[model samples]
Structure formats: C-alpha cells, structure tokens
Target: MQITVIGAGAWGTALAIAASRQPHAHRVVLHARDAAQAQAMQQMRRNERYLPGIDLPAALTITSGPLDALLPSARAEDLFIIATPMAGLRSTLQALQGVPASVAWLCKGFEAGTGLMPHEVQAQVAPQLHAGALNGPSFAQEVARTQPTALVAASPHASVREALVQAFHGSALRVYANDDIVGVEVGGAVKNVLAIATGLCDGLDLGLNARAALITRGLAEMTRLGVALGAKAETFMGLSGLGDLVLTATGDLSRNRQVGLLLAKGLSLEQAVTSLGHVAEGVYSARTVHQRASQLGVDMPITEAVVALLDGRLKAFDAVQVLMGRGPRGEAV
Candidate 1:
C-alpha cells in the first residue's frame, strides 16, 4: 500500500492528503518537481503557491524526484499516481523509464505537441506500463477540504480500474470504475475549454440566457470532438464530461472562468494569467484542442472563439457575435 504521487501542484497536494486517509495508512509520498517547493511544503505543511494554510499529514512525505521515492532498491511504489501537469508528463515518465508497474495518472489535459490525451501520450512513451486515469468534476480545493466528491477510475485493463477503486474510494470520495478510458480522458480535458467560454460570459456581465446557451452548445461541441476522437457519446453525459463541464463553468473557484472574465474586462492574456498566479489548463488547452478538433473535422465553435480571443485575433464580444451568426442548423447539429 505504498503510494507515491508525483507533482506538487494544488491537485497533487490534494491527492497526497487523500492518500493519507487510506485505511491501512499507506506510505504516501508527494514528489515536488522543484526541490525548494518540496522543502517548503514539508516545512509549511501547505502548497503556498496554490493551496495555502491547509495543514499536511505527518505521514505525507515530499521529495524531488523518482529516485527519492520510486528507486528500485529504495521504498518501491505499490501505487504511483502521476499528477504532474500535461506539459511535463512525457518528461516525467521518461525520468521514470525504469519504474515498476501499477502507475496511474491524475492529469486531465491533452498533450500540446502531438495533441494527444494523457493516456495516449503515456502509451506512446512507455507502452508496457499499466495506466489509468482519475477524472470527474472534482476540484482540488474541494478534495483538500474533504467535501464529498465522486470520480471515475478508468482503464482498459479491468484489474487496474478495480485496484484504483480500492486505493482511492472511501466515505468522502467515491470512485466509479469503467473501461472507457478515452471517454473519461476526453471529457475531462475538453471541459476546461468550455469553462473558458463560460468565463467570458460571466466577464461580459451577460445574463443567464447567454451563459445557458454557451454551456449547452459547448457540451455539444465537446461531445462531437470527443466522439470524433473515439469516445462514447454517453461518456460525455457522465461525470468526466458533463459533470466536469457544469461544475467548472458555474463554480466560483474556476481559474478558467476567472481568465475569461479578466480578458472580457480588457486585461491581456498575460496580465490575466499573471494575476491568477496559477496556470489555468483551459487557457493553454483551448488552443491545442481546437487545432486538433479542426483537423479531425469536429465542430467546436466555443473552443474556436476562445482560441481567437487568446491569440488576439478576436475580442470576446466578437466571438459571441460569431457564435450567434453561424449558419442556423438543427439543435442536434
């Protein structure tokens, strides 16, 4: 029951806390990529950059690399959760090239260079490892706060899914198992882009009418792209897809929404991101996912608009106008 969670971001720190609650009291290690960050988390008992003031469990150890936690001779990992961001997943995996099996990823974004989902990227880099993805509407803050949350643990391998359910599920956290890894991964990643569109609506001071329209239509596009990428339509309606979309778009804690609001109020993308003091996955994913959607012939107007606004090619208001003016079609289209 030894668990190693790689990454020191808000979500990663939250996972460390969650692991500390395991009944058997697993050896939970949080790997901070930055050595200074690791030392700070160990001393302050908080990820001061993101989730501050939350005390960490004494059993939750922080380290800088795989050598510190997953070394073959050292304390081995019975369960390793790769919670690192999408940008560093490949490099992180590469660093653990000799890592043992039973590794899972908590990342929920598509890779930038190849436009691949986290699982796809994982398979490409290390094809032999058993991998699963944990995804849903759950937020890091809520998870850290022990707010009740539900998420799906999905993998093509049945054993991996069941093991994940056993390791993470408990009273405050619920885990559902499924074989549709692509569906869950796609749903989780695309919701971030849709959240950006919702943020723009909020920033513009638009009424509920506009926000409602954007959310509904954004779901449609997300499903379209997800299905085009080999995911199930029903999966988009499940926790990873619809659940995440609604929570992130409407929740006050969403950085994606904050970014959109900032841009709507005349702040540059750089300024907005700087003010947030944390990376908003949607801001970067919107551009990458949008490009992949276009090449796949999936209709993603909302994603397109967000990309335009981020690229400075179109204003937020203009993007809305474009959405409204697009050729009228049936609701299903």
Candidate 2:
C-alpha cells in the first residue's frame, strides 16, 4: 500500500510514520507546506518540528507539493489521509483530481462554515469516494515513537474498515474497526474543545475536584450532542469518544490543553495562541460547536463555558461556577 498523508504537523507526521511502519510493502508520503522542512525530513530521517526525537521510517517520503505530485496519481486502495486543518479541507478537495478509492481523515474539527465533520465534508465535496476517519486518544508524539496505543478506523463498510485495520495495525499500534464514523470523528474533534476547559482548570491550579467535575460534565455534553447527531451511545464510551475525551483533557501532550495552561499564566487567549505558534483545533471549534449544539438544544455546558471564556464574557473560575450554577437536576441530561 502506498499511503499519502496531507499535512506534516505533529499528528500528520506521526500518522505517516505509523503508515510506514506497516509490514506490507508501503510507501508513506507526507505533504508539508515548508519545502525546507520536507527536504530536511528527506535528508534527516526525522520530522524536526513535531517528532524530533523519533526516527522516521526509511520508506517514508516527504514532499512539499503533494497536491500536485501525489493527488493526481492516486490509485485504488492507495490510501490518502488528509491531515490538514479543517479550514483548507474544501479547497483541497476541490483542487484534487484523483480521489483515492479509499480515503481516511486524520484531520479533526468541524468545517468552519458548514460545521461538518471530516467524513461529512468528504461526502459533501466528493460524494463518490469511500471515506472514513482515524481517531482515538492519540498523541502524535507517542504514535511517532511507536508507543503502545489504541485507535479506531471507522467506515460505513466493514470491509473497507478492516482493510485499514490490516494496513496500519502492528505490534505497537492496536487498531479497532467500527461503522460509526460520525461518532469517532465528532468525538475526536469536539474533545479538543472540552480539553481546553479541563486544561484551564488544571492550569489555574483549581484543584483535582474541579478538574474531575469538568471532565465528567464535559463528557455528558459530548455524548449528548453525539447521540443527537445519530451516533450510537456505545461509540461514545469507546476509544474515539470517552477515551479520547479523558486523554486530551488531562494529557500534557495536547496542544489545546497547553493553550489553556498559557491562558492561566496571565496571557490572554490571543496571546496564548500566538505563543503556541501552531493550530489548536479547539480554538476554531469552540464557537461553531457551541452554536450548533445550541441549535440542536443539546446540553454542552463545558463547550459553552469554553466559548464564553474565549469571548471574554466568562472568566476561568467563573466558567466552572457557571456550570455549577446550572439549575439543580438529575445526573444525566
């Protein structure tokens, strides 16, 4: 299998390494925006920016012009994983000529305008192609290093899903197959926003009690909206949903959580984002997700608080207070 991964950020680069690690004859091609970075990866056998210490596989190739070079010649079962940010998804889909027979999205976050998941965008933009998503409690650094990790590759077709499981599964990576692509993609994307809330709580030194409350309350919101969108409830309890929610909320490797840390350090949201110098999906996702959840009448206090905090309408502590102040009711919404 020849796997082409678009984008060369932390997660994208890591997925490339994971694909290269597959036992079958494989060529893992990565598209990086920076030609210099691509050239360096070609020479150095490592992604200097994202996975610095981890060694890239020999079969891995990095290219700056993947849209022109890789997308034009995509063949059947030649998996193309778009790991780019959500903002560019539509345009990239538009420009690409040869849509691979099987496409996997490592990208998360809703489409800015349409508020669609990666697979939803794929269906909308390229209806004829087979599409799915790769997601879980995955941190790019750990994946690049071949750390024992569990992830989900979800497609509507069980056969297509299994092929990806077989293509990428190895001793270091534990892959699960599912038909709930919506649950997995939505879980992976929305968790980042919820993670920011927990991250803020932790960074503020708000106590373990506060953090626990936030995570528990956040999961309710996540699951509620996911179910509202037609995702099975059990999917939320699996790796892609609750598993990812817990991990990203507490994991130090999360960019969204790190942003919260910076925010707690007295820097404003804008200042914190500027310092990170990378795309944090949570920031762009917060407003749209909260808006959509509201339209659906789904309970998402954590998301609402995150949005409130970002809009300067709520303080970090006050966000928690706001959640706490929600009228007394039963545990489940």
Model 2 lDDT-worst window of ten: 92-101
Off by over 4 Å in 2: none
lDDT of 2 by residue, 1-333 (tens): 677788888889998888888877877788898889889888988888877888888878878964776666677767777787889777666655356557777777887878887777777777777777888998888888888999999999765687678768899998999999888877987899988988889988989998888888777788888889889988988999889999999999888998888777767999989988888999998888887788898878788888999888987778778877888789874
In order, the Cα lDDT scores of the candidates are 0.83, 0.83
C-alpha lDDT of candidate 2 relative to the true structure: 0.83
- CA RMSD of all predictions: 1.7, 1.6
Q: Write the per-residue lDDT of candidate 1 for residues 1-333, one digit (tens) a residue.
A: 677788888998897898787686567888887888888888888787878777888788888854544657432237778887788889776656566657788877778778888888878888877778888988898898888999999899876787678777988899998788988988888888888889889888888999999888988998888788888889888898889999999997988888888888989999999999887888878878988898998888888888999999998899888888999789993
Per model, how many backbone clashes are there? 0, 0
Reference-based lDDT, residue 330, model 2 = 90
lDDT of 1 at 137: 85
Best by lDDT: 1
